[model samples]
Target chain A: MTDTLLEIDNLSVDYETGRGDLQALRDITFNVNKGEIVGIVGESGCGKSTLISSILRLTAPNTRFREGEIRFKGQDLLQVSERHMRDLRGADISIVFQDPMQTHNPVLTIGQQMLDIQHRSKQSKADKRAHATKMLGAVGIPDPEARLKQYPHEFSGGMRQRIAIAMALMSEPDLLIADEPTTALDATLEVQIIERLQELQREFHCAILFISHHLGVIAELCDRVVVMYAGAVVESGDVREIFHDPKHPYTRRLIECDPGHLKERARVLPTIPGEVPDLANLPGGCIFRDRCDQALARCATEVPPLDQLKEGHHAACWLNHEEATS
Target chain B: MSLLNVVDLNTSYGAVNVLAGVSFSVEPGETYALVGESGSGKTTVIRAIAGLAPAQEGSVTFEGQEIRGAPEKVMRPLRKDMAMMFQDPVGSLSPRLTIRSLITEPYRIQGMKDRDLDTEAKRLLEMVNLPTHFADRYPYQLSGGQARRVGVARALALEPKLILADEPTAGLDVSVQGELLNLLNDLRERLGLAMVIITHNLSVVRHVADRMGILYLGRLVEEGTTETIFNEPRHPYTRCLLSANPEPDPDARLDRIALKGEPPSLLMRPSGCEFRERCPFSKEICTQTPEWEVNGGHGLRCLAPLS
Candidate 1:
């Protein structure tokens, strides 16, 4: 039997806006297995960030978890105390944000910040410093000892991002939430970061919930993919299956829209012909029906349940559901 | 004659030399792309060409007229034949202005008071496939894609022969980015406008650019037709960049030529090849600078080019 690291079940989230309550995430469900990289792919306003925030129990003041549970190690994280959550944060889970320029304290040296993250550990100062140096070296930083003494601003953009990843993995957490960690880097540097992450993940034996809008990066790194649209999970399957044979119309269109998939130079690239619906006043059907090309008439009145099409593959679309049922 | 020709363009900010003798030429109705990593002076090349950033030395000829060091009075009339689209979608637009005033502000700036702005605004919006009613909305009311369309509309207000676009498809969804690319391609063909696009996205360069130049440390490492460069890249840096770009297909080969270390700082550039530090094919001969060699239509500055 496969070991499940984290299970998010039927989670729903809403934001209190001036006009009305904005439903950011609706009936979201996914699971990360031990030592597996799962990617969450979606466009802006599709609640990718909101899903990350909800898992860390770090929602904004004007937000509320409408329903569902985030179970980690068989215990519901939503039912945990603030103190318990705080203890579990760095020790059990950690995050690397998009912009490394803002990830660290400007005044603090890299060595100081690295040691500070390991404050929960009872190890001696010398041991922690040694660990920090090794971690920096693992991320391919040159002269780890001298580099640790320097400030974050002294590092280049690629180096800063590498250092950020080093700091996040210092505790050797079970799950690492990389929220567009390589998005800010250049193409060459992005490749380096992805390779380093792959190496580091294998060494640390930690699961990764990689979230990004770039389909190429997702395809490169993720083993399984969870495609989100309009604050809902439209498709979740093996990376190969999702890219090769996408069942949901939204997933198919998304893959087709990527410029990397274009074999020849065409005058007009295919595009979805509509905008994302307003979250405050959602339509009474599939969240993606407005932009979905293969949307059926039934899709306008009822939301299709996530149906199992094949082993370890699921898609939420009326067309897929009919195909599976038939 | 070429539509625009920039020969040995050199731009420097203080002691740091940003663009070091970069040169390229664009024919009328041709689309050329400047591709590079950040700090590689892709934007600065266009800025230098537009005279927004002063060039230390170079010859920029537009329509057979010398514009390199032309005075403001002489350059003022040239502005009507050239337009620029800034990188940011919403940030580039004036926040207080309505869509109507924003797109037609070019006419006002040029002191062309004889034309009716409302009709011009409607025409520009229709050209960009946006509803004419959008002219009444403010910049804040539009989405990223819509704001980009407005930027395009503003750039096309003067009906320029040449357009300089910087990261036109950035900060949009895949579908939205495709829409913008299609719009740009359609407009370029319909207007027969020559364009110089600056972006790091190789996919975008492949889609729209007829020819492309790969820049490293403010110098063109390689220049050739986009099809040739993608198929048979000569420079190690160009090959690395092409291989590094993550292809969306899962079945595509993942044999990435992982570049080592970060790009060296401009303040203390490495001797000889600037890309040698990260290049996997660096040899002893790479210590000395390679000549910019051109054969047929392809050119590259490399001591040991890929066969």
Candidate 2:
């Protein structure tokens, strides 16, 4: 088996706007190895969602694929036909969205929904129910057997999210993409969900692409962390290494701004001045230049490439490039 | 006298009893954080204080004067001294109204036409670190952070002595959230204004709060200084909530406590302790309303002793 499970190379996508095409994902390149948990961290409008959609070919009608290849299990997913993609979606690749309520059918019983999705499994109806109950129990849902009869409204928000996770894993897909699954949950529930996800990952051995803006969740669950700013990946490295010694200025600012790690009652939290740049009228050179604290004169004219800072660590910044050249 | 004191505040919506004998007080120039999960009645406590949600039983004394069950005319004057920032900025600000009009609406409501509203509006915008040009734009033209800043500006129109902000940083980016939090902290220090911040995030509590009260099933389960709550929590729920908050530092080892599920609905709320169903350390005594164990400034309502 190949070590890499999913590979996204130079993938660029744009959305059709009134004036012209607005670039959402620009030359984004990354890899998820077999059974590895990769985290994508970025602010809103940073193209994290676009990147996820690109993997499943679920981009909007206005979305235009400008460049790059998305290879899943050595086969280019972008080149696959619609029929083939459909088979691959839930069977080989599954996703858990941020809002579980939207994903679930409010009127249907949990068993009915679970059984409907398992038609492709070719298992007996009774067998499917057994598997569903087991998966739900694995996700820390109590009374899984009795819960199968309950409607979506019967469960609480956190429990609904857990049921969603259970449904996502019922197929035992090779790759799982969770887009801010715990963002809606409380802090305590967030911890429970992340820990449960970690435990499930170990048991299932599925490659996970976990996307979140919460740094603490990323730090706790991810083996590798990818930091995105604007529409591009600003930095990527091991979770601990990146958290301890962030290479990119944007990554540094993102980490420093989090109040989760503050040891004392902070008098004033350090803030990044200015607003996120308009994606339609993006600045030249680095996308993060306008809000970046360490932008140089050359940053206005030259776009920085993802330069290697260390083994398995890379940062896309002019400062890093200059340091390497010097 | 305390700036705001809520004693045995009990509120209910028709058949559902939301808050059951909730009590807390905020001193002058203090930042009090009320935190809880969804359906814990954190927002209800704030709404109760603002007179939006009237308490069925209890007394809310502001500056040593009883405001609960007060007449509309009596409450009208007090509105000028207290302002509230809603959780959803987009919903809080009217889409048709320009930023300037929104900020000055409070002054216009109080029938103060003599004041220089135009200048006051500009100063309010600047105080929230929003650009002067944004004053001309409608609420829809602004982003989430910008709209929140406008909400803060609107909340400060009457120069309120006590500010009640409900999740001021919700749905904002990391940097923007930090900036808004710092702005609130700075404003509190500059104006010596007391605040009651209602939120679900413990991180925000750690940053700006002086004291914090944890609510469960509309009851304040624990209350103490932020330092004491984080370092040495006596309540099982408080300890679980603190440990459940994932520390950003990867090196820190966390011992997480797994609760059964979310708080039961208000309709199906357990008799004694609202948290009895979900508390891992719950015992038979938890079925009865636990007595408040007070020590120094820290206090918790629980049957189980801290391990």
Candidate 3:
């Protein structure tokens, strides 16, 4: 019996904009195993947020999608009723966003806001408060009881983010989706958050879908990684394998573009020239061909499929396909 | 002599002090990066130097001219030789103005009405790698990178010798950030422009800055060349900061020397050493302020033995 916790197959979504229909996500297929951490890495406008929204069924009003199946624990989430979905959200699956202050209500006290999340629970008020305190302490928040009375404005940015994380795990969710949770944090605070998250993930035994544009954070936290480019999953594999030996051109460029990877400062850091393609008016075939240095003549005419490069490693690129067949 | 010198700088907002006894200098053609976490007073240090934020008890000299608390008449003509690039590129640019006028507005302020504004605007646009067609477009029409480049072009409109760029690479993607840093570096080399760049990103400092100062809770705790700072950081906070920066490679062995807690609040700062509460090497003497220990021009404010 496979222990797949969440399975996303051929997920495609488009947003209706004034320019036209923007193909935000294209034929994305991946799965997260039970208690495993998966990271999605991409630049801006690469459909990372759209993919998360699709999983939560929280896409924008003008979003159009029909060719995908999002299954959580062998149950199709798309087919679930709205009421059932609402129950499953905080209890089964929870998410933490980039900005915790924006996610929280400024007018309410921290304690009141956390208790509000537990309205569906059958536990008494006292038990819920104790549970909130415990979860807050679990995230290394000091003096959780005293902090409950304080409003969001009273806490620092890092502390507010910790509160957000604690609230996300209040219901003991089986899966936590953190979208750039540490992006807004300072370097020292980022390390603190990552350490606390790793500790809590083990204590709760939950799978995590970590989404970020920072390759460094993803490399340190995620067990497996998925590289996104122009609304497609260009590469997916174990973190170690993908970092040591990235097969796709786009994934390689993304890694090379990181300043930390450089041993010494160069006159000019190598960059992946050209902006991400316009989704509403994408060119024929592969999306990355325009910026890819090793793009072959056939790359502009044929769409590459996600082919297996090694055990548990996959990349969608014509170069990888040709190398595999040769 | 240094192109810009800041000494014993202290700044405050009402009751709370933002910068305390901070000091640094920028040589001609050199990039001095002031690095710290948010609220650590990195921005305040540059703002104090630029005269936007008043220095409570210190001196800021540009080309050996005191301007920290100088009157507007004395500071106005001096401002023409200094330019500031803001953090938020979109918010900094005027939404109603065209790119052409935005670049030339500085010249208009300098009372150079005889200059051909359109040609100069196009030249500035091309210098920042923006297309000539963008000169006619409004601020809302450009991408984030384009907007930032436009910001850079506008900053260069005055052709200032010294540029104070506040988080120039903030809110930019990695690839775009690399390109922007390269442009800044190239301009510095080609034009010998001295820059005082305030940013929290250590990677950017490592790539572009010749020298750096690490700030913690409004104090300049460490100052040294970039190579020495990254290779052998003396202060405990500097060591922890470098270690905490997540390296991109998965296999890079990072020493897990994380600080115990978040920075202490400014309202109730620690009595003596501002970082004493969070420093791993805090001891009995840490209850009192430690003198700046200097050796070979590299300095640190901690009493701990160098590792």
Among these predicted structures, which one has the highest DockQ? 1
- Total residue pair clashes for candidate 3: 0
Mind giving the per-residue lDDT tens digits that candidate 3 earns over B105-190? Answer: 99898889888998999899999988898889999998888899999999888778999999998767789999999999988888
Worst 10 residues of 2 chain B by lDDT: B256-265
Give candidate 3 misplaced runs (Cα > 4 Å).
Answer: none
Whole-model Cα lDDT of every candidate shown, in order? 0.91, 0.89, 0.88
Lowest lDDT sum, 10 consecutive residues, model 3 chain A, at: A317-326
Work out how many backbone clashes candidate 2 has.
0
Superposed by TM-score, candidate 1 places the C-alpha of residue A74 at a distance from the truth, in angstroms, of 2.5
- The residue-level lDDT of candidate 3 at A9 comes to 90
Please give me the DockQ of candidate 1 compared with the native complex: 0.79
Please list all clashing residue pairs in model 1, or write none if there are none. Answer: none
Tens-place lDDT per residue, model 2, B1-307, is 8999999999999989999888889999999999988778988899888888879999999988899988879888898989999999989988888889999999988999898988998899899988888889998888888899998988888889999999988878878899898888888888899999987778888988999999888888899998998888888889888888887888878787887776777887777776888888888887787877678988789887575
TM-score of each: 0.96, 0.94, 0.97
lDDT of 1 by residue, B146-174 (tens): 99999999999998999999888776788
